[model samples]
Target: MKNPFARSSRNGDDGPSEIYGYRIYMVALSATWASAMYGYDSAFIGGTLELPAFKTSFGLNENDSTSLSSNVVSMFQAGAFFGAICGFFFAEYFGRKPVILGSGVIFAIGAAIQLVGKISALYVGRIFTGLGIGSHSFSDFGSITASTRTFRAQAQHSGEFRPRWLASKNQIVKAQKNLAWVRHLPVDHSYVVNELAEIQAAVCQELELSGEQRTLVQILHECAAPGVRNRILIAVMLMLLQNLTGINAINYYSPTIFRSIGFTGTSVGLLATGVYGIVKMATTAVFMIWIVDRFGRRGPLLVGAVGAGVAMFYLAIYSQLSDSFDRVPPSNSGSQAAVAMIYIYAIFYGFSWNGIPWIFASEVLPTRVRTIGMMCAVCMQWLAQFIIVYSLPYMVASIKYGTFYFFGSCTVVALVFAYLFVPETKGVSMEDMGVLFGPDVSILAVKAQENYQEFRRSTAMAATEAQQEKQGGLHVENA
Candidate 1:
């Protein structure tokens, strides 16, 4: 009873070890680009919304400003909600690649609409952009999840299983014992009894499968790979948290915030907002390539949260100082300090919290549910954005600068959330993600790895048996 699934010892050395590789980096880079587009679309409106050309053309007035802003922001989010709903269907049907490409096209179209609409003050253009962004966000989530899952699956399939050199002797002994057991199994037992015993043994020795059983083992492994499912849950949770950070308030209200800081000119404020977008893009790129892989997810999140909180606190203080200056008619120095603090706030925001959260949201989820989860996450995020953007002007007008303190407090909460819940996934393979999250996290990933091992063993054993048959044939010919 020779084992048909076992491979020769030589075949065991063909796989590679786990370390960061070029292909994996490339995938991450592509996903990062998708996230950048999301940031661009999201933040661009904040600057452009304030242009007199935009305002007058759109029939915007100070009286209805908050409502108008809310409508615009919320519409984008509303479109996103529908897009996420669509992602669940598309991701399952079309696979990851097509959905992502489609998303990009949709997003680009949305941006294009905004660009065209800006000229005519047509609300239709803004709505079109919102539709694209919403749809694209859904596709982006699916793509990132699929890409990560594929990487993990490939890694597990081609990964080396390097048992210790000292363990080779033990392996040999174990092989001998296994062979002995195969030989001793009763060949003349009652057929039914023997069959029943074999079934029981197969169930018991689930991890140590036989050569003929290798196919089943491989199937099981494929089912267990980590990236196969649960991505949606993680994506949704993370995205929801990102929205809760209140960064959208800053994005949607940048012009007003600048004005409050003493930048009286509309053109200056708009220019500053554009500069903010550039800073966000540049800083996100740096974080993705150098910082994300180095510091891990939690560190940046915490650092960003704390830094944002401090900045917002300064904003609140600056607001109060300006009010005092107005009352007391203080020197120009106080005004200058207030203005500098606002710019400082923007810089800190661009560097720390704004872009990084979106990246984090993209990376953490498992493959099967990634698109659905991302859509859910982003939907909640946009909805939150809508609320904050819509409410901020009124809050500022009614409560003065006290709204800054509220946002700063929320940043502290975001910090705590990141520290407690978010795992560091910096360099971990997608296949191994199940192990990191928990044993039950990724059934597909775990199963996939197991199946691959079983398939390898089965193929090896089959080859060995074929070689042995050929040798026997040669011996018979000589006789």
Candidate 2:
């Protein structure tokens, strides 16, 4: 496809299709609010704590606020970690639409709890918000078949991208119905028939290879499966490294980050932090629309690591040389440059770690265990994030200039990791993920496509016979 983000109807065919339509974008937009809400609060608590009014209301002083700040921020991450784990399980049981809607409702309630102006109430609210986040959608392209997720949020809305899952459950009719509806084709249409046939065949091959029931023991065993295990490892490592980039450190404590680089005054630090957020927000859009697919995952990860690492190193140097927030409110040119480096870092991060890890993690899993595998991945991400947010305040308080250095070094390591381990997933088919990662299932997919052809032929023959019978009956009645 011209937009290689989309897959062609034919397997292994990288041609264009009409699938990348508006409905897809709308559903993508709906899932976005989770991350949007999550990000807002990750940045919100720390910034709010910096406010003189907030401190007064919360019974805290600015000088002794690090513990309080960490508690507030870390609580959210803790909730998020657990919420994400449970969300995946529930999503598997109930489906995505409920999880998506429920999380929003939960977050709204949590947000309301925070408005009560009491610390205990605030903590509970933060936890509620965490559950609502349940782990964010890793990438924008959730399902080509699920463009109407937003519409589903309305009346009678409960369908998602579940072809393989449905096929695995042997619900061939249901899978066919869904695929036909999503693709705007008849159930017997070649595109719909072919897709369902391939999906069924893939599931069959998976079952034959595993030779195990969909039991707890077997699911656990597949975790150690040759190809599946390696992809899981990659996902775990990527999630770990995603947080090691210190994006959350900036996110949770941007005001503190700005101050460490010699910017003084609450308003001044917040202004810098605001600009940093703006840069991140804008760059994220650019990455999603064009860079993610065009430049591909590996290139952005490598380049972003290089660029963001450089920016971090600069901030570290600036933090070391400057008066370290002892300067006047306006700040010096070097201090200004440090602020600029944070924005520079945001640009790189937004383009790279902000979304790539999630995308890659989602892409690498097999169909059957995709939900559980993603649950584990999401847990790792939140666990790492929780650790970062909980420790960053103390890291800044104790290490001072060393905080930037620590994060800067992580980026260098991230650069090496991306270079060594990350595979290029752009324009790759789902079947190819198994081949690329561990199991060489390309032969299986080929055989499956062959089976799909047979299925199509048999189906057409059956339809022709049924039509013939109908015509004979009509002629007899007329006579």
Candidate 3:
């Protein structure tokens, strides 16, 4: 049987097909939401730590501040690290949805513990939150992979139908040709020529048809074979991109960022931090609704890096100027400027980097490897987070505002990496993506369309040969 969706190769081979847009959007949206939660959990602590009750209760001091901060902040990353490590095994064993749900429960529990005012308990909460984020990250990637695979399968099935449909239409044309043959029966050569021309035209139309629909038809005919290798590559690239963004650094050190922007008073700083969390959550909600679908993944990422870099540079400059002037209390104008920069940073970071990386990471891998790949990527991110959280205060104190310069520099590096490597996957389906990006598969999904066309041709040729053989058998039977 001929697959309708397969496209014809130049050498007459059939290939995979493309997917529709709506299906891609639905999968990406669901996967991106998981990332939003990831962002929320990572950033929520920033504001809470700024609360005076939090400070006095913990007996924080300048000398022990960094250690205390690291102790509190690092737990989540530590949990995340372990979670990601464990996620690989669970995702592989249980599938994506269950892992995501499990993560959500962990995150909710962590948030509940923090809300209850137990400083020690907060660490336990952070661990659970981290675990959830890590596990969910893997699950999300798996979901996208599954979605892409489905799209590819659909396209392939569509390709298989094209040839059969065209063949059915040709049956009508062939009937016309037979009638013409009978009408010109007295004119032997003329009747034969006309009949052949009609058959040829029908054949040509079948051969010429190509596109995603065509490839789907071919795959259907071929029994919907899986495109395995392409799925792995997509997962790997997603993992790399998620870590390369440096999102972890920003999430881990948002409070330090608030302080650098002139909110040095612990009370004011913590309040601002909580506000930053609200902004992150709010912005992520907006992104899930409006931006993720409209702009594609790379646009928000580039915009975010630029925004973060500029804010960091401003903070760095302000730090240097304040230190150089021996300004114990900043001038009102200077203070206002710092506050404004911090807010801007918060808004920008919230909108772009907070939710997008998780979304991209989750949707890029296939079901089979989604868990392992997500785990690897999330672990790398947490490790990066651990470095930033553990060392940020020391760097800030030693270098003063110069620390901002370093972070700013890192932002530029992340931006460059994003532009060069990230692909726009806003509306790509899971299954079709498998064929589109599979190892040695064509990146141009149109190739699947071509594959579909080729399959149709083969099916037609086979059907024709079968018909001839059947006719020969019938003649033999009659004799």
Best by TM-score: 2
- Rank by TM-score, highest first: 2, 1, 3
Worst 10 residues of 3 by lDDT: 157-166
Which pairs of residues collide in model 2? 1-14
Per-residue lDDT tens digits for candidate 3, residues 110-213, read 87887666667877877888787767665555444334333332333212111122233345554444433323233234533444454445455535542223
Per-model CA lDDT versus the true structure: 0.56, 0.73, 0.58
Best by lDDT: 2
Candidate 2's residue-wise lDDT over 211-262, tens digit each? 7477767887888877788778877888899899889999878888777776
Error of 1 at 127 (Å): 2.9
Q: Say what the RMSD of model 3 is.
A: 15.8
The CA lDDT at 237 in model 2 is: 81
Runs off by more than 4 Å, candidate 2: 1-20, 135-162, 170-174, 186-188, 325-330, 439-479
Candidate 1 lDDT, tens digit per residue, 445-464? Answer: 33434544554578689999
| Alpha-carbon shift of residue 175 in model 3 (angstroms) | 44
Off by over 4 Å in 1: 1-37, 104-121, 142-237, 324-352, 355-364, 439-479
The predictions' CA RMSDs to the true structure, in order, are 15.4, 9.4, 15.8
